[model samples]
Target: MSKVLYIKANAKPEGESKTFRIADKFMEAYKKHHPQDEIVTLDLYKEDIHFLTVEDVMVHMSNEVEEKENPMKRYALQFKSADKYIFAEPMWNLGIPAILKAYIDYVSIPNITFKYSENGPIGLCQGKKALNITTSGGDYTEGMAAEWDLCDKYLKTIMGLFGIFDYTTIRASNLDVIGMDVEAIVNKAIEEAEELAKTF
Candidate 1:
């Protein structure tokens, strides 16, 4: 069966986070379509995915010499096991959260997730897809605020390093602070997510 890795980057549990609610709706729709598919949810807030340090980089690079397996190795394995990936995060400081970035640092290793070649760095994890579900308090669709969207671009670039080019983004920007209809905006994001889940 196809496997999907859902990474929840929000620290808030349930009612406090609007991003979590949107992610839950997207996952529900995905489950309805692919009931038999395996779903692995990685809650970043709960997990202790430490930021990459110099020691960690050394361990990754000297794996052959050290010949010892570690937690980072396990993380890399888990990342390779997924056929599809889903990121649920809120836009923070025009970018993703620190936890998600930490996870990415752990997974993006040379000769594992990707490799350097003469042509360029080639992604080893091919034939995989990804979906990024994000919410922001600021309006960033197609206006003066569009250029400030760093979340989508960062996620896309990181996923592309693993050869995951087939991707979709579900964004609900200006949800809380827009002074507009919040329910309608959220429902619209849900509708978009449902449609995207069908294609996935």
Candidate 2:
């Protein structure tokens, strides 16, 4: 069975978060479709992920730091071993949450998730797939506002850096837009998530 890492980046709890609501449907459908697959949920807020410090960077740069001795190695190891990834978050100030970014940094270690090459940095974690489920108050998928969207764009770019090219994003947008039917929009995203989970 495959290993799926479900990374929850929102500060809000599962019940209050719209992003989680959609992800919940996806998880339910995904479980139904892939019962044998192991799903591991990493809740960023609850995990209290911290930003990398100077010592952390030094440890990563030094080959002398053993995997077991490094405080942050577990995150990278967990991330590297996963066959699939699910990122669920809400758009905050046109980007992702601070904890989520910190968690990404924690797992993006050289030689573990990537390595240096003569040409450039080559990702070590290949043959992996990722799905990004995000919610935004404003619509960022089209028109001029799309330029302000850094959440999905950044995640896709980072995933590619890790050699995960088969990345998909399911965005729930315009939920807070005035005069729009919020429930309808969310329900539509939930349906999309459910369908995608069937084949994901």
Candidate 3:
């Protein structure tokens, strides 16, 4: 059975977060479809993730044995071993939350997630898929605002850097717009999340 790593980055209560609700639906459907599969939920906001210091960065850059026993090695190991990954985070100020970014930084180690090659950096965790579920207060699909959308593109690029080329993105937009049908938008995304999880 495949192992699924679900990263939850929303700091709000689940009931108040559309992104979390959609992720819950996806995970529930995934369990129903693949009962034998194992699911690991990592809450970034609640996790003790340290900011990488200059020395810490140097330690990872060097192929030293000390890096092998790093206290934060768990995240790197989890990312490397997962068969599939699901990232649920809301768009905050046109980008992913700081906690999520910190988690990414924690896992994107030199040898753990990627390595420099003769030509360029090569991703080691290949052949895995990622599903991104994000919510935005304002819609940016077809306007100058699109230029301000950094969440999807950033996450997608990070996933590719880690060799997770196959991915699906779901967005709940205009959540804060006045008179907008936020319920409809969120519900539709929730439904889609369940459908995608069946085959994810």
Candidate 4:
């Protein structure tokens, strides 16, 4: 059975957060489809993901430095071991949350995730897939704000850096707009998520 790392980034709990609800619905279907697959849920808000310092960066970069007791290694190890990933995050200020970013920082090691080559930087982590889930109050997927829609795009790009280019997205866009059927929009996204999960 393959391992699926499910990362929940919304700070608010299930009943209180719309993003959490969408993630929950999608995960439920995913579990149903792949019961034998090992699913590890990493709640980023609750987890203590430490931010990297200059010293930390130096330690990772330096081959002579024997930094064996690194706190980030466990997080990095788990990420490296996983065959697939599902990131359920809320779009904040046209980007991702600080907590999720911190987690990414911890796991993104130079030789571990990627390496520099003559052509360019090449990703080391191989044969991995990802699915990014997000909810936004404003519609950034279309119109003039599309340029400002950094959440999903960032997810794809960063994951691609680690050799994960095979990815999909489930976005519940424009939730806070006036006179909009938020429930129907969420339900439609949930349906889409379920369909994707079957193949995912």
Best by TM-score: 2
Clashes of 3: 0
Tens digit per residue, CA lDDT, model 4, 1-200: 88999998877887888887888888999899999999999999878776788876775675532244675666776888899999999899889988898888877777677777898888877799998889999888777899998888888898989988898889998899999899999999899998998989
For model 1, how does the per-residue alpha-carbon lDDT over 61-150 read when each residue is reduced to its tens digit? 854422326667667778888999999999999999989998888777777788789999999899999999999988777866778888
**Scored by CA lDDT, what does every candidate get?**
0.85, 0.90, 0.86, 0.85
Can you list the residue pairs that collide in candidate 1?
Answer: none
What are the per-residue Cα lDDT tens digits for candidate 2 across 109-176? 88888888898889878999999999999999888899999999999999888889999999989988
Model 4, TM vs. native: 0.93
Ranking by TM-score: 2, 3, 4, 1
After superposing all C-alphas onto the true structure, candidate 1 shows an RMSD in angstroms of 1.9
Q: Number of the top candidate by lDDT? A: 2
Better of 1 and 2 by TM-score: 2
What would the per-residue lDDT of candidate 3 be over residues 1-106, giving only the tens digit for each residue? Answer: 9999999998898798889988899999999999999999998877887678887677667664335467456678777889899999999989999888988887
* Model 3 bad stretches (over 4 Å): 65-68
Indicate the worst ten consecutive residues by lDDT in candidate 1: 62-71
TM-score of candidate 2 against the unseen true structure: 0.96
Which regions of candidate 2 are displaced past 4 Å?
64-66
RMSD of each: 1.9, 1.2, 1.5, 1.8
Give residue 53's lDDT in candidate 3 (0 to 100): 85
